[model samples]
Target chain A: MTGVTARRRGRPPRAESGDTRDRILTAAREEFSERGYEKTSVRGIAKAAGVDSALVHHYFGTKEQVFEAAVEVAFAPALDAPDAVADGPLDEVGERLARFVLGVWENPTTRKPLLAIVRSAVNNETAAAVFRGLVVSQLLRRVAARLDLPDAELRVELAAAQLVGCAMLRYVIRVEPLASADLEAIIARVAPVVQGHLTGP
Target chain B: MTGVTARRRGRPPRAESGDTRDRILTAAREEFSERGYEKTSVRGIAKAAGVDSALVHHYFGTKEQVFEAAVEVAFAPALDAPDAVADGPLDEVGERLARFVLGVWENPTTRKPLLAIVRSAVNNETAAAVFRGLVVSQLLRRVAARLDLPDAELRVELAAAQLVGCAMLRYVIRVEPLASADLEAIIARVAPVVQGHLTGP
Candidate 1:
C-alpha cells in the first residue's frame, strides 16, 4: 500500500516550499508599505508571515534583501514594458509607453508596491538608492537605448521624470481632478507630449 | 553724549534688526542647500549665521519654519513664472516656461534650497507634506486656473510632471550629458513638449 505521504518530508515539498518564500515577500511588502524602510524590520516581516524570525533570516539574510525581494516582486510586471513599447511603431511609441506605464500604475496589484517604494524614497536614503538603481538599470536604460536622437539619454530621463511626476501628483499626492480623471483621457493628452520629447523637432 | 544721537537711534535700529532677519534667512538657505533638511540642524544654522540657536528659533519657530523661510527666499523668483508665461503668446508659452524653470535650477543660489527641499521630501513626511502643499496650492492650482482645457487640472498636473521630472533627472540625478548641455538647447527641445501638455491639440 502507498504509505501516507509523510507530513514532514525531509524537506518541504517543492511546490509548497515556494509558497513560504512568496508569503514572506508578501508580508514584507505589506510591512514596508505601511511602515516604510527605516521603520520596517526583518522580525516584523517574519511575524507578519507567521514564521520564525530565524526562518526569515535563513531565507533572506537581511532586511535589505527582504526589501529587494518585495520590490522585485512588485516591479516584475514593469520589466516587460520595454518590450511592449519597443515592438510598437515609431510614431505610436509615446502612446504605447504611456499606456503601459499607466496600466501598471492603475492596477492595485502593482500600485501598492510602487507607492511604498516611492514613499520610502521620499523619506529614506537606503530606499532612494534602491529606487535610483531600479529606475536607472531597469527602466530608463532600456528606453534610452531605443531612442535615436541627440541627448537621447536626457530625453529618456525627461520622459521618466514626466511619467513619474504625473504619477506622484495623481496617485501619491492625490492632487485634484488628476487623481479622478479617466486613464485613457490622460494618455491621449500627455502621451504626445512625452512622444515629442522622445521624437519631435 | 547727552540724549542719544538721532543717527544711531530709532529707524536705523529697526533697519539693523531687519538686516539680522535677512542674515538669518540667508544663512539658513545656505545651510539647507549644502546639508539638506535632515542633516542641517537648528544649531548648524545658528552656527553658520554666527548667532545663537535660540535666536534662529526665535526668528523661525522650528526647523520646518526655517525651511519655509528658505523656500520663500528661493522660490520668490519662480513665483513670477506663471505671470511671465501667461503674458506671452500661447505659441511661445512652452519655451518661456522651460527657460524660467531651467534658469531657477541652474542658479546656484536657488538650486541649493530647492534641492534641499526636494531631497528632504524624499525622506521626510513633514517635508513631503510641505512640498505637496506648496506645489498643489501655489504652482499646480495657478496653472490649472490659467488653462481653458477640458481637464485643466489634469493638464496642469501633467505639465508639472514634465517640469519637475526633468529637474529630477537633470539636476537631482544628474543624468549625464543632459546635465552638462547648453541651457538654451535643452530649453528649446523640452519647452515645446511641456507647452503641448499645458495647451496642446
Candidate 2:
C-alpha cells in the first residue's frame, strides 16, 4: 500500500488512477458539451483536465472511445432499468421503467451529458454509430433478457421508443404542453402506455 | 401573357419565379444535408442552384429562412395529421396519425430531407428554434384544435412523441428488431398505444 502511494503522483495502478480517470472523463464531457464532438480535440480535453495529452490517450484511447465513454455515463441511469425490473411486479414494470428513464432526463446533471451526446450523435455518423452500439441497444438487450417474451426485443424497443420520444419532445425539441407539463402527471399518463407496450397482449 | 414570356432569362416575374424558388429550396436542402446547417450558406445554395446569391437572399431573406423552408417541406407529410383526424373515426385516430407520420419516413425522398433537417436541428440552436416554432408545434396546434379535449395539446404531443420516437429508432438510430420489423406490423402494435394517448380513458 505504501509503495502504491509512493510510486507516483499521477501514475496508474493506484487509488489515484480512479480519480484521474474520472477527472479526464468529466473534462471530456464538458469539452464535448461546450465545443461539440467535431471541434473538441484530445489536446483540448487534456488541457481542460489539466493533464498531459498522452495521459488522456493512456486512459481513454481515441476521441471516439472518449465519446463512447461519455455516452456510457450519459446512459448509465436509464441503463439501470433491468435491475429495477428485477424487484418490481411485472405488470408495473412499465411505470418503473418509465419513471427510471424519465428520471435521468429529469435531473439536470445527467441530462446535460445526454444532450451533448444526442447532439453529437445527430450530426456525426461516427458518433451516431457509437451511440447506436453503446446506449439504447445495450439497455435493450438487458431488458429483453429480463422480459422473457417471444418478441421480447421488439416489445422492449417499442416501449423504449415511447420513453425516448417523449424525452426528445419534452427536453430536446421542447414542444409545449408536454415541455412544461408536470413530471408526475406525464408519468401517470405515459406509464400505462409504457406498461401496455411492455406487458399487454 | 406576352409580357411574361418576354421577361429576361433567370429574372423572376411569374411562372419562372416559382420554378426558381423550388430550385433554390432543393439546392438549400442538399447543401444542408451535405454540409450541415452551420456550414451551409446562402451563397452555397445559390451556387448549387446555379443562380445568383442575391436571388436566394431575395427569395428566402436569410439562411434561417432557407432552413425553415426545408423543415416545412420535410414535415409536409406529417403535417397533414389534422386533416386525417377530421375524416377518420376518432377511435382509430391513432392508427391514421401513426401511419401518416411513419409513412413520411418510409419514403426515400421524404425521409432523406427529414434526416437532413433533423440533423441540422440537432447541431444548431437556430435550426432547432426554427424547427420548434415552425414544424411540430404548428402541427400540434392544428391537431389539438381538432381533438377537442380538455388537455388536447398535451395529448396530441404525447401521441406525436411516440410516433416521432419510433421513427428516430427505426429510421434514424436504426435499432434492430423494431428497425427491421414490418411496417404494418409496427403500425398494428403502435397504433393502439398511440390511440390510448389520443382518445383512451
Candidate 3:
C-alpha cells in the first residue's frame, strides 16, 4: 500500500495500466469508426492516443486483437444477452431478447461504436470474420445452449438474424417506420417471432 | 416493325440507348464494388466502360442517379417479391418470402452486385439512405400493402428484418452454421417465424 502512494507523479505506475489500456481502446474505437478496419493502423491509433506504437503492440498485440478489444467494448451490453435467456421464462425468452437487443441500438452511447463495427464488418472480410466469431461463439451459441431443444442452434441463429437485421435497418440503415416506430410496438410484434424460434413446435 | 429492321450494328443505333444504359450500369456496379460510394466517380465508371465521361452524364445525370440505377439492376430479382405475396396462399406467404430472399443471395449472378450494395450501404450514410428508400418504398412496402390486416406495414418490416438479418449473417458476414446450413433446412426453420409475423393474432 505504501509503494502505491509513494510512486512519483512523472511516470505512470503499473496501476495506471488499466487507464492506459482504456485510453488506447477509446482511441482505437474512434479510429475504426472513422476509417474502418482495413484503413486503420496501430501506429495511427497510437498517435491518436499520444502513445508509442510499440506501447500499443505491448498492450494489444495486433490490429485484429485491437479490433477485437474494440468490438468487445462495443458489444459489452450485447454480451449480456445470454442472461436474458438464463433469467427469463423459456416462452418469454424471445421478448427479453428482442427488448435487450433493440435497447442496445436505442441507447446512443452504444450505437456509435456498434454502427462502426457493423459498417466495418460489412465492408471488410477480416472484420466480418472476427465479428462472426464473437457473435457465434460468444453470444449466440451461449444463448442457444440454454434452450435444450432440437435445432436449438439454428433457431438461435435465426433469432439472431432477425434481431441483427432489425438493427441494421432501424439503426444503421435507418429504414423508416421501423426506424421511427415505438420501441414497445416493435417488441410486441417481434417478440412472438423470437419466442416461436425458442420454443415452438 | 420497319423501325426494328432499320437499325444497323455500326456505332450502335441511337435506339440502342438501352444497351448503353445497361453497359454503364454494369460499369458502375464494378466501380462501386471496388471503391465504394464516396471514392467511386462517374469518370472512373465511364473509363471502365471504355466510354467518355460525357456519355455517362448523358445517360445518368449524377453519381447518385447512376448508383440508383445500379441498385435497381441489382434488386431486380427482389422486385418480384410483391408477386411472392400476391401469388401465394396467404398462409404460405412466409415460406415463399423466405425462399425467395435466400435464393437471391444464393445465385452468383445476383450476389455480386447485391454484395456491393450491402457493403456500400453499410459504410456510407448517403448510400444507406438510398438503399433504405428503395427497400422500404419499392420492396417491403409493396409487399406489406397486399396483406389485409391491421399494422400490415409494421408486420412486413418485422419479417424483412428477420430475413435481411439472416442474409446479412449468411452472405454478407458469412457467419457459420447459418451460412453453410442446407437451404431447405433454413427455409423450414425460418418460415414459421415469418408466418407468425404476417398472420399472428
Top-scoring candidate (DockQ): 3
**In candidate 2, which residue pairs clash?**
none
2 against 3, candidate with superior lDDT: 3
| C-alpha DockQ of every model | 0.41, 0.66, 0.79
Task: Report the C-alpha lDDT of model 3 over A1-201, residue by residue, as the tens digit.
Answer: 667666654365765887888899999999998888888999999999989999999998999999999889878767876666557677788888788778888888888778778878888888888887876788677778788876888888888888998998888788877889999888887888788777777
* TM-score rank order: 3, 2, 1
Each candidate's B-chain TM-score, in sequence, is 0.85, 0.86, 0.88
**What is the C-alpha lDDT profile of model 1 across A75-127, one tens digit per residue?**
88688777777666878878887887778789999988887786666556677
- Which of candidates 1 and 3 is the stronger one according to TM-score? 3
- Stretches off by above 4 angstroms in model 3 are A1-12, A77-81, B1-12, B15-18, B77-81
- lDDT (CA) per prediction: 0.76, 0.82, 0.83
Docking class of 3: medium
Q: Which portions of model 2 miss their true places by more than 4 Å?
A: A1-17, A74-81, B1-13, B74-81
Task: Report the number of the highest-lDDT candidate.
Answer: 3
Single out the weakest 10-residue window by summed lDDT for candidate 1 chain A.
Answer: A1-10
Give the range where candidate 3 chain A is weakest over 10 consecutive residues by summed lDDT. Answer: A6-15
Candidate 2: tens digits of C-alpha lDDT, residues B1-201:
767677655465786788998999998888898777888999999999999999999998999988888768766656665577545677878888888778888988888788777777777779878877866656667767767999988888899889988998898878888889999999999999888888877
What is the TM-score of chain A, computed separately for every candidate?
0.89, 0.85, 0.89
Best by TM-score: 3
lDDT of 1 at A173: 58
lDDT of 1 by residue, B50-118 (tens): 889999898889999888877877788787776776566777766776777677888987787787777
Instruction: Provide the TM-score for each candidate, comma-separated.
Output: 0.77, 0.88, 0.90
Cα lDDT for residue A100, model 1?
76
